[model samples]
Target: MTSGWVFEEAAIVFVSILAGIIFFYISSPSVKHEKKQQLEEGTSLIINFVLFIWAGKIVLNIHIFVTDPLAVLAYPSDAHAFYMAVLLLLVNIVYKATRKQMYVGTVLSALVPIFLGSAFLYEFIEAVWNDNTMSWSHMGLLFILLILFLIRYEQIRPFTMTALIFTIWSLGQTILTFILPYTTLYGYMMSLWFLILVFTISLIALIYNKRKVT
Candidate 1:
C-alpha cells in the first residue's frame, strides 16, 4: 500500500512538471522569441533542484542509504530537506552564473514561471485526487500568479515580477497555515517557518533587484 501511494505521488509530480514545461514551451513563442533558452534552462534547473532535495533526503538518512539504497529511495523525503535544498539551489545557480558570466535575472525569469506552474498543478492534483482541502489556498495564490504572468510576460522586468510572485505566494501560504495547520505542500506537512523564510528571501531579492540597474 505504501509503495503504491509513493508511486502515485511520484506520478502526480511527473505529470505536473511535464504540464508546466509544456506551458513554458508554448508561452515562449507567444512573446516573439524574446526569452532565449528559458524553457531549456528552466527544465535543467528544475532537475537540479529535485536532485538537490533528494541528496538532502539521503544525507539525513545516510545509514539507510548505506545499507539499503533501494529502501532509502522508497522512503518519503522529510519536509526539512526542502529548506536546505532551496538554499543550495540558489547557491548553485549563483555559482554557475558567475562562472559562465550568465545573467542571474534571466535564469530566474525562466525558473519562476515553470516552478509556479508545476506548483499550481501539484496543489490542484492533491486537492482533487487526495481530497486535500488545504491545497485550495495554495492553488488560489498560484492561479493569481499565473494570471499575472500572462499579463506581464511581455514587459516583465526580470526578477521583479518573479520575486514579487514568490513573495506573494509564500506570504499567502504562511497565513493559510495558521488557519489550517494540517496544510501540506508538495505532500509534506506545511511549515510556517519555511513559508516565512521563503517570503523574506524573495522580498529581499525583489527589493535588491528592483534597486539594482539592469
Candidate 2:
C-alpha cells in the first residue's frame, strides 16, 4: 500500500528471517557439542538472546497500549533486541565452528573481524530503520567481542591486540565526550567503562599466563 506500510512489512520480514537463521544455526547438529560446552561454561548467550527478543516484544506491546512520550522510547527496543540477538548468534556460530581448532589464536583472528563487522552492520541498520542517531549502546557489540576474546585468552594472542584497540577506542571516545557534551556522550562513557572492563580481564589473563610460564 503506502511507503510506510512497505517499510514496516520489510522490517518484519527481515526480523523473521534473522530469527529463523538463529534457530537453525544454533540447533544444527554440527555445533550441537559446542553448544553443550558453552551452556556449561555459565555464559548465557542464548538465554540473553531470547530475553532480549521477549523484552522487545513486551516493550512494543506496552508502547502500543499506553500513550506517553516515554512509550515511544520503545521504538528502538526492537533495534536493541535485534542487535543483541545478531551478536550472540554470530559469536555462538563462530565459536562452535572453530572449537575444534588446536590454537585459540586462529579462532580469535577469524572471529574478531566477523564480530566487529556484525556490530557495525547492526548500528547501520539502526541508523537506517529506527533512528538516524547512533547511540553508544551499539558499542555493546564490541563488549561482546571482548568477552569472547577473553574467554579464550589462553589460546589467543590477538586477544591482547583486540584489547589494545578497544582501549584506544574507549579512551578516544572519553576524550571526545569531554569536548562535546551531548546525550551521545553517555555512549562514550559506556564505551570507556567497557574498555576498562576489557583491560581488567586482559590484565588477569596476562598475569595468569606469566605465572604459568614461570
Candidate 3:
C-alpha cells in the first residue's frame, strides 16, 4: 500500500479515538473529578483496540506476516479485524470488571459517550472527507444518539446509560436500513438480523437493569 493510504487509515483511527475522548470529557461530569483516571482508561482502551486490530490483521494474514512482517504491517485491516477488535475490547472490559480492576457503571458512562462521539466522527469523516455521502444517513443517526445521550446522561440512572444508548442506536439503525441503501457499524456492513438482535439484547439489558435498580 502507498503511504497515502496508510496515512488515511491512521488518520481515521486517530480521529475516532480523539472524538470519543473529547465527548467523554465534555458530557461525563459525574466523573469529571477523575479526569486523569478516565483519560487513562480511555487511552488504554483505545490502545488495546488498535493493538487488537493489528493482531487481527496479522492473524488474518499470517502467511504474509511469516514471509514478510513489514509487508503485513503495511496492509490495512478489514471488517473481520474490526470485529475482532470489538470482541477483544468487550472481553477486556469483562475481565477487568470481574477482577474488580474496573467499575462497570463508571466505565460505561465514559464508554457510551466515547462510542457515540467516535462513531459520529468516523461517519462524519467518511461522509465528508471520503465523499461517501451515503454515510450521511449514519452520521445523522449517530448525531441523534449523541444528542440524546448528552441530554439524558445527567438524568438517567448510572449503569443504564450504555444499554439505553445501544438500544436507541440499534433501533435507529435497524430502521435506517429499511430506508437507506445500506448501513454500517463502524466501516463494516452489518446484517439486518444482527442489528435487530442488538436492539433486542440492548432493550433486554436496559429493562433488566432498570428493574434491578427499581
Q: In model 2, state the lDDT of residue 72.
A: 46
* Candidate 1 structure quality by residue, lDDT tens digits, 54-100: 89988888888998998878877778777668788889888889798
Predictions in order: lDDT? 0.79, 0.46, 0.82
| Residue runs of model 2 more than 4 Å from their true location after superposition | 1-75, 78-111, 122-156, 182-195, 198-214
| Per-prediction tally of clashes | 0, 0, 0
Which stretches of candidate 1 lie above 4 Å from their native place? 29-36
TM-score of 3: 0.89
lDDT of 2 by residue, 1-214 (tens): 3545545644644453344334333432335665344333312443445565545545546656376644443333344445445455656646755776234443344334433444444445555665646444445535554455445544546545455445544554455445545212111123444445545655665566556656
Q: RMSD, each candidate, Å?
A: 2.1, 10.1, 2.0
Clashes of 2: 0
TM-score of each: 0.90, 0.36, 0.89
- Name the lDDT of candidate 3: 0.82
Per TM-score, what order, best first? 1, 3, 2
